[model samples]
Target chain A: MRCFRFWPALAVISLAACTTAFPQAPNYGNLGRTPSKEEIQAWNQAIGPQGKELPPGSGTAKQGQEIFANKCAACHGPAGEGSQLAPRLVGGRGALNIPTPSRTLANYWPFATTIWDYINRAMPPKQEGSLSASDIYALTAFILYRNDIIPEGQVIDATSLPKVKMPNRDGFIPQRLEDIHDLRARGCGAGHCP
Target chain B: MSSKRSLRRQFLKNGAALAGFAAGAISSPAGKLFAADAPSADLHAYGQRSHFENDVRIGSLAMWPIVPGARRDYGFRSPLQDSMGIITPAPLHFIISHGHEPPDIDPREHRLMIHGMVDRPLIFTLDEIKRLPAVSRLHFLECHGNSAAAGPTGEPRKALAATVQDTHGLTSCSVWTGVPLALLLGQVGVQKGANWIVAEGSETGKHSKSIPLEKALDDCLVVYGQNGEALRPEQGYPLRLLVPGWQGINNVKWLRRIYVVDQPYMAMMESTKYPSARLDGKSRWFESEMGPKSVITRPSGGQQLGARGFYEITGLAWSGGGAVRRVEVSADGGRTWKDAQLQQPIAPKAHTRFGLAWTWNGEEAVLESRCTDDQGHVQPTLAGLNKFWGIDADYYRLPPATADMGNFNAIQPWRVSRDGSVSNALL
Candidate 1:
């Protein structure tokens, strides 16, 4: 008899727990409207080392020279000699390995992909990643030729691009990580030698 | 209208930050962390600025400054020399961070855990770790990439005095007080086969690293105090692992967990990014330890002097592998060198301040410094250093093996003009 009496109460408690008090929704004062498709598309683009975000269309080194002369010559100087505004991209091969390494691309940079990636990310300073896929290829080819890495007449395309190797491809050294195990085995502390 | 409102908000925020700095000055046990002799008003104004200061608070163990605002740009560096005795004061020590602001951690809630290849898993609260027997010693920590630009054949030889604090200034030595990692590893019972130990931080980026397990069982320390005082928020408050003779990056900050493993943690900061220079014309996977170098500080760059007379050329010298036994300063370029006076109680792996007095002939002259650590290793020049490492491996600056190359100890030359103007001119 006592169990039967508590059962109904338990059922009523469970039912009560299930119900939630719903208040009238508060009004949210609207601020800015949703962005348009064009706005969204403009911000979504990014170019990876493998020409991931490259746009359609093709261009040749001949066209790229016109673009380079009109746009890049001011800062980079003719033939990428580099003015005060920009860094010299040519020369510097085997320079980083010399005592007191200068750390330029020719001397220290390990990957050719870095050139493509950097150009896609931060070239022109003002207009970033605006070049079409063909333009990028042409620019890369032109720069490589100017750096004396590639033949001036060599044609650069998707299939032939990845094959190019940088002089500093093997430039990096492994991190020492300073195991400090030997130091400890020898009994070293802050001040007193172990 | 929006600009006006924002200006008002800025005022309120500044007011609040000022109050916080003032409260810290008064309530903290160390008292005014900088310029205590001056009135509170002047000190408050000085605190509001964004420049690094030279004055250090008296009685603080480590020579650190109470940085007023959060990280605005790159963090500040502590002065290595001009300090006597060991134990860098907490306020005056060096500061380095990548982001806009340094993380602030609450010690009461903080805990460090050891996991992975350990026989037994363990977690120790900050309080529990503090209860263990502590050891304090003065030591220096240098960023691996320190002096990356100031190598052989350049103007701004005095870049050492000015730039040292910027690049190498990431280093500091203080009487760190903490429970040894060996004790902690002993408690957890490190697994037999485990060779590498990876330490992870709780900061914004979750920066992590893999150190040799032997190091964890050796002299690595989980420190809570610097220079006999509680660690500052900027200097990895609550707990920071001190790995002597290693690059600053390997010494994990805001330490949270230690995982024992068979292989090293090839985190981005280590394998791909930091490592530069390959042997088969390929990358050297790992290179560590900052080599010997010296920089003059008192007559550093970007300072307006009252009048040029007899000024002492003084600066700090240090190494990672061992103690700095000797330091030489050259005022007439590297053609000749004079021994600079080394401060006493020079502990191994700590900054040794050296000074030399010179009377300027009121003409232009070059200034540079060199150091020899406890180990037989000597600083090298850029030209010599490049021959061994290769031009590609220019990212990190390791300790020099000889005075011949590697650019570790390229003779720094600071040119002083007749008008008392000091500039880095490669003469």
Candidate 2:
């Protein structure tokens, strides 16, 4: 059996010698070929409807400060004042029902993931979606700080960002399942969602 | 241009002489009077107002005003401050759209086609539509996103940049004369499998909505005439769908087609963009009915209070669900509530005006009004709403489920100061 294997190896070596383009395909135009499974898997990372596609590489809040100042501060303002150009990102933690002159994400924005997904898909304006995985991690950390979730020197990354609790995260209730029966039972009228 | 200029000069010159003659004739008395010579409907032509109004007016000629900007995605706001009474005048109502220019539809060439799951898929001409059994009602049609503003919080609440009219002004009520959708469905004979009817507009990409067939047969209408005249161009001239108590989008404008199906069409209006409240962590969709809401038109923001004398706090309250039974006013914040007087004969799905007498103490206090519809649904407080529906959700249609269900009916308090500045107390 060993002798037969050696013979096959020898045959393959000879076959390679017969081709003119030894490490390259001679038919380059046919290069519209499917990539190998491994190659496809490497770039298929995406966070999705089920929260399964998160990529690797975590960062911290301290690192996030650097990322925010460098990439986000210009448009959102140094203190997140928000401009006609872009919306303010933080501050105003409890202005929901007070006679204050200001409000920000700290008082409103319902979901933490909304922040993450928004930044991931649309932030770093000049080069949206161009932030590296680590850059996103760091930026998330910085914003959480500005929102006053985590203090200075706190490091945010995949692990900590998801765990960091948010106010008003549970503000909305799921839509009630209603049909003709429900509508009639409820005496469907204006203001009532039937 | 030259002819117009000459006509104006001639009219001015003759008008002066005519005025002199009329003045002399009236002085002489009897049959000499020019009262009978006043302009009549024959001389004035159609579309002219019988009486002049001091209030700001727009789009009077076409029945609908053309918004200043041509971009279909944008529209003009209604002049809420300038308007009087509960019913927003047809011309001053805010007009919003989604990428559809005004269509030049000919009623003679138009046909409202009812198809899909039906015993008889029939196409009715504009005349045939008018001839069908008709029912008229005075109701209000409002946009779900009408009050898009920057909330007292940092997040945008009523986002509209225009006046309260722009934000809350896209509402109107008129005697709509047309065939009841129920009668039409009876005529067409909707099949048992038909549960949803998708209303289509003439504008491309803007046509489509899935409405429950039962609801359609109940209160929907194929409206033609508005305010005793044919529908205006901006108001879906020729024809439009009126789903009573439903969101404005459900009432498709420039309606061109109707498709009945067992399942919802899953159109863009239903799948995405409409606001839904989140409850217990799930998103709601296709919420058509607007909640009971009220706006204190008088003493509203930007209005000047000349003095601290007793003044009437007057405003309009309406519910897409039903008639507004009562509206409560809180002059000292939400601490105490007193019922405001509701105007007589409150009709269902109509704008009912409410008034209350208040004596300003010339102190910084909160003034708020909360409406309770016939359905017994009370208005939620801003703080209570913020607990579940973050002020920054960007979507007002459906709020999310949160630990803050306890805050559902928090009183929406408005702060008023001696300086006459009125703002949300929940700043």
Give me the candidate number with maximum DockQ: 2
Per-residue lDDT tens digits for candidate 1, residues A6-123, read 5676655555443332212221222112334454344323222243334554444566687788767777777777655555667755444333334455554444444654565456
> Which window of 10 residues has the lowest lDDT sum in candidate 2 chain A?
A24-33
Query: Candidate 1 lDDT, tens digit per residue, B1-427?
Result: 1233323333432342233223111111111234323334555544432232323211111111222222122234554423444445667676554331346788888878776666656667787787777898777876554444433211212232233333344556787889788877766667788777778776654556767776667678999888767888867887998887676777788887777766654553554345533334444433445667667654544222234467777777777767889988887767799999998778777878888988777676677778888776666654545454454333334332111111134444556556554444322
Query: Over 4 Å off in model 2, which ranges?
Result: A1-194, B1-43, B47-75, B148-163, B275-282, B388-414, B424-426
Candidate 1 lDDT score at position B6: 29
| TM-scores (chain A) of the candidates | 0.59, 0.60
Q: Model 1 segments beyond 4 Å from truth?
A: A1-194, B1-75, B79-88, B150-167, B278-281, B303-309, B389-409, B425-427
Candidate 1 local distance difference test against the native: 0.56
Q: Predicted candidate 1: what Cα RMSD to the true structure?
A: 17.1
Query: B284, model 1: CA deviation in Å?
Result: 3.0
Q: Across residues B1-427, which tens digit of lDDT does each residue of candidate 2 receive?
A: 1233324333432342233222111110001112222345664466444343323221112111222321123334454544456666666555555534567899998767776567666667787777655777877777665553332111222322122333355566666778788776665567776667878777534446768887898888999987777888878889999987777788888887777666554443443345343433333345567778777665554344545667787777777778889999988777898899998658888878888998877787677888999889777666545554555333333332211111122344445667654544444
